[model samples]
Target: MIRAALVWLMLAAPLAAQVTEPDGFRMDHYRDPVPETVAGGATISPEGAYQLWQDGAAFIDVLPHAPKPANLPKGTIWRDKPRHSIPGALWLPNVGYGALAEVTADYFRRGLTNATDADPSRPVVFFCLNDCWMSWNAAKRAADWGYSAVYWFPEGTDGWTFMDYPTEQVRPMAPQPSQ
Candidate 1:
């Protein structure tokens, strides 16, 4: 009986680890919501994104900004670094996420208005890292805000890079003050 119990524990331990292991650096977590039907606009593929880009779509990157490191040496000089994005994509960080907090919504609205010159008919595409919800939410919000043509690129920057699509360096937008 003692031998059987030991064997069972050994087997269960590995299984438990596998079940509880964190999904590390993978684009598979949080299944793509609204895969078949976007709330307001259509979900697009990498190829479609490229086509829209060629047609002059306004690509928006909705990836959240990584917090800046703190505790640097007082004299440490930080230079402006180039961040990469789909060519011509406006880096509107922090606008994506399933929940449209008032602050985030305002940022999205302002970004759209500023980037597209308040033209609702302008073609717009929203994306982030693959499988992230930020792009999904942002695209929906644009459509809800009366944008006539909105596209959600489900295959995000990863997919774009994988396809060898052109990327350009961009600076992220500053956080807007909360209402």
Candidate 2:
């Protein structure tokens, strides 16, 4: 029985490691972390997000930006296909994890200011893909920046799409270089 238990423990070791491992680039593969609070904002459901939207909350999409093609031939017209988000959501790609950096943080601040018209009291919701941490981090950043009302829509674009909500195609703005 002891030998059998040892074998089982060895088998479970790798699975335990996998569970605790930090996700690098693939943020959409795991389940959302369960906590009463994230950063400084509270997690919100899709229905809650819908209500917030109806109440005139600003929505920010914090999905990672697709990398530019490295070796496009000269004169090749390389336009990005329009990306879709929950209707009225501003596509602020690369504002998730990158916002942790000082330069990117400045950019996020500016974007949030413009999105909320510099009104710190305005309600703001942040989201990315379902199960993604980018929105969580961004929402926290907003709260840290002294925003009065900040929320994290953990259900993200996937959840919104799953609910058959209407989406609008949007063009992403180029990020300004960090000064």
- Could you tell me the lDDT of residue 34 within candidate 1? 32
Q: lDDT tens digits, residues 39-106, model 1?
A: 67888889999999999988899877765569778988767555688988888887766566797778
All-Cα superposition RMSD per candidate = 9.5, 7.5
Q: Write the per-residue lDDT of candidate 2 for residues 31-120, one digit (tens) a residue.
A: 455333565567788898998988889999988777669898888787776678988888888777732667677778888988899999
Q: Highest TM-score: give the candidate number.
A: 2
